[model samples]
Target chain A: MPAERRARPADAAKVQRWLDVVAALLRRSPDRLTFVELAEQVPAYGRGLRSRGDERWQESAVARMWERDKDELRALGVPIGVYPDAGGNRSRYGLETHEFYLPFVHSLDGTPARRTGGPPGVSMVAFSPEELAMIRRAAGRAAQLGDPAVADAARRAMASVAHDLAAFDPDADHGETVVGQPLDPTVLRTVGDALVKGRRIRCRYRSMHRDVTASRTLEPLGLVFQLGHWYVVARDPGDERLKTFRASRMSAVESLAPNGAVAPPRGFALAAHAASREAWELGDGEAVTVRLSVAVHIALGDLPGAAPASAAVGPRARTRAATMQVRRLEPFLRWLLAFGGEVRPTAPRHVVQAFRDLAARTAATYGAGS
Target chain B: MSAVARFARLLRLLPKVADGTPRRIGDVAKALRVPAALVREDLQSLAERVEDTSGGFIEGVQVLLDRDHVTVRSRWFRRPLGLSADERAAVALGLAMLAQEGPAESVPAIQRAREKLGRLGPGDAAVRAGRIGPAAPRTAVAGAQRETRYLAALQQAWVARREVELAYRKPGARAAEPRVVRPWRLVSARGAWFLIAEDAARRAARVFRLDRIDGVRLRSATYEVPAGFAVEDVLRDGRVFMGAGAGTLEVRYGPAIARWIAEREPHERQPDGSIVVQYPLADDAWAVRHVLRYGPDAEVLAPARIRELVLAVLRRMV
Candidate 1:
């Protein structure tokens, strides 16, 4: 051996690379092949050690290398066993399929990915083909979301995961029902990175309320996608309240202090923040109750805060009355107006008057004097 | 890759050789594309770890070396492969959303996938994954169930590479007529779904809206889509009916509605906060209906013919 057995496989990165090499050699062999035979069959191994003179090409070096390879692969969960000389043959070491494979029987949860801790990471669990295809769909969605880097990462992850299941029997059929709105891919990826890393971001955002387009630094808490749009729920440092910003309206997204020890305030729930209110309702203001009579043919189920008349209506009725709250008056008015004459504000004389004034102008635009 | 990640990969590699037949370290390494030296070390290390944790080889796993083949013997190794909880949840959410989202014909497949994933049995933590958000609301689906049959039929034709007989109705047409088509791809844009296929009668390509496809039936014959055909190229080639043409129409939006248009629609904004939404109109009547959508918030300043058409619709309505 050129060197002592002091080298450690603690750095799994390097070990990971070596593990790939060893697994490759073992997988191609149908029967047990000795370390001596391995050194001869593997061109790279012999060439690498011989070329670098890193280790003397001898029995001691060979034995030491064998020991280390076993340690790293074993660390990975491969159960490699030694077949003792049964009929006066040299002891051979290899992985026997019956002993190494962990076939899915029942339990979904078991060993942790790592014996140590960080954030929650992957620990293998039984996944059907349907589960895999579902993951593939998400990866596809993430790619379409406008960022190249994320797209590449998603593509790679999908490929690697799909590769893991290549040896398994077909589990299920993957369908084509997938559909999702395209988003600014860059923003989705950037915000997702920030949310996971507890990073702050600086963005030049165009506020929906005003003409102001300025750069603001915020601590992003989470991301929410609604109605084909992506929004980042974030908070200004030192501020207790979180604000939402449409990702598309922001530009020059840059992360700040990725390594800084930061996290959302204790118990900050991303799901709650995302689903608490519709994006339009994120505007700051006092809520107002308003009633609207929409043409009977128009469905108000998707409208915010809309509830229909509980009882049956007369046959002659042309409209159905529903009530909802309004906070962002501009957006609310725009939405109501978009329905044209099919919608009418029936309560609050001031709001009604406002709607009437807009209606008159619209009527005039069509040369139908009001 | 951390030691943990390596461990995870190691676990996955187990099933590759858990059959109890001793495999050569060299052969296993070659198949898995690893160095034999490393494979040898991995087995030895794992054997000890499993032993220490679960009372040495006899309890759960066995690792040994005989005549250079590293063999393992464990009945439990035949277990199904593993995925993380977050990963499972993400997959579940994707399946749920795809099922609810349009491409409605695909719902059955998505449902099957969901069912299979759900079949991991009771006490399965994946089943406990909270409700998944839809990719897009069901409004598009509810807007027209009449179009679903077309979607399903065409989808079948597309998957099987077969020709289809389509009863397509034009945007303003009152009736649908049968037209044979070689279905190619189904593409989505700006909240609308369009089927791109070769029109056998015209011997050219056409883009038909899902709603406009009043009826479809899979034909007996199959089709071979031209190799390397790109849907984007075809759709961009004079297929986008409402975009880019010889001239741009000039119209202004009121301050109240202009911001909304500027925010959601493509247009140019004026210094005074008004927005001009430009459209390349093929005809004045089309322009009139499009602008009338904004009601009084928008006006056609030029093309007197277009203004007259708008007045006709409004005056008639009043």
Candidate 2:
């Protein structure tokens, strides 16, 4: 193989990273890039080496890099062509960003997108000193007990209040006790770590449905804090299945030896499995597909791209689509109902029927008509 | 089903319509390529909804025909509002947690919510004197969001019963080429995200990491997730993340490290304030870094060979 071809594998990511930087820059500025200027503008290249004191690019290498960039641009199928601006030795690269740039326009203004627009005529309420302290202290504690993201949010909210205390005008209302929770570093870090690493962990888990403490070797897959408690998607070793464990109920934990050394079956994916009905099961079982629909409102939030990928926007919306698969059906539907009518099953007619049947049962218990 | 419906069907969309600007009916019609009347009908249906617990009617829907504008608004109240200080704190923490999504338009939301809440209180410095909890390190939240997206995508694909094609890179692999496969499930253990899926090319369910999936695609074909397949069971049967252990490994933990260990369950804790851990001697390597996290607080106690390994690590660290 030629030197260019031989070195292709090693240089691809650097090339791609460079290309990403270039693309981002082009998308932002949409101007030509001089070789020297390119080096100065690209983040990786721009960070250091301002002077280009010891620049090393062979004539052949520069040609190769150009060819690679050309191929990459062609792959995008846009009419991106480089022109030697003036002399053969000098060149400027340019691409029309209108084709590639994503126009992200804010639909609303900076004013509060208030989901809960407090009572009309209620500009603000005032709290007593004791109430204010209680609210701040409570928020701090809640942040500590929750996930890192939530804790961070709580911290920011409190900080904003503290920073703008004069603006808040605490005297608006007096003697009103404000409730809050502080962030708990211990629990947040623990679940955070488990979710980041695809490792099976042991925890003294407590379930909301039952107050009993049980030791569980769990493969934590996801974490969500809802209704004042943290929930973890863990693969329980005892029964060999995934279950949502409440972090608040977890009294203690005892790590164990890594699960035995065996390979997961061919084509086995936890995400795919979680989407399957089988994922809801806390016991070992086969995978099943669980189809459901989210109401348009919930859909925006739950569907892909509603919130920034970096935000804790509930569960991550699957770009591929919204359906869920798992090892069992019952648990998945139970969680689905948390959204009430906002979500409905479209496939596995049996699953939908089951949900309907359960709803009917619930309605009957309350003596309500369908 | 059409690809749009098929995609929608596979992944359920649960509407979470909190108070926000409703998309213009005309815009929805244009995007979906439907008639204005049809779009208006859909909007009307949506506006008629009184499904929430509050049972309030949807009002304030503004459709300006002349301006070709549309907006939906509803004034509904959620109940059980008298939150205790603890509950208020939890909500505040949840709001703080919202910051992890990155600085989106939501920053304004946080500010507004704070302002609204602040206005409810007196401006007395002493009244608002208590310190707010320390903010989580920004890097931590950013990292979690990045990881969660990959995990969520993998999980969504698995749940949708749709095949996933991914370009994966494994550690120590000479190449970082794209590898396509059908993703089945995602699991996170030890602060790392792993995807367990079937490698279409290999025809086997292989374990991959979220950080390693360079590209992900949902195949069109519907898959039949075997009624009895569970991702958790597969991992427990020693199928995921554990390759054949290559060598004996041992480590010790001090009190300072024990709490995190207890949190992570790296080993079984004994009543005597000690913990014991074991590893197979064939499939796992390149995990030395993970073992060393305990630092001097950990010492390898069992298996002379593994003990020596721990010592070597300590020596290197020293």
Winning model by DockQ:
1
lDDT of 2 by residue, A223-342 (tens): 554323355556655455446555655655543445653223456444344332122654567766665555333323343222222233344443222455466666565445433344
- What tens-digit string does per-residue lDDT give for candidate 1 at B24-71? 878877655666665665665555431112211122345677658877
TM-score per model (chain B) = 0.63, 0.45
Interface RMSD, prediction 2: 28.9
Native RMSD of candidate 1 (Å): 12.7
DockQ of 2: 0.02
Score residue B97 of candidate 1 by CA lDDT: 39
In model 2, the runs with Cα more than 4 Å from the true position are A1-370, B1-146, B234-249, B254-256, B266-274, B279-286, B296-318
Per-residue CA lDDT of candidate 1, range A140-169, in tens? 544443445444544433433443354422
Docking class of 1: incorrect
- Candidate 2 per-residue lDDT, tens place, B14-128, comes to 0112234545546656533446564453333333322221222112222222235455333321101111122233445434444433235444555455444533222223123
User: What does candidate 1 score on TM?
Assistant: 0.56
Docking class of 2: incorrect
- Model 2 chain A poorest 10 in a row by lDDT: A171-180
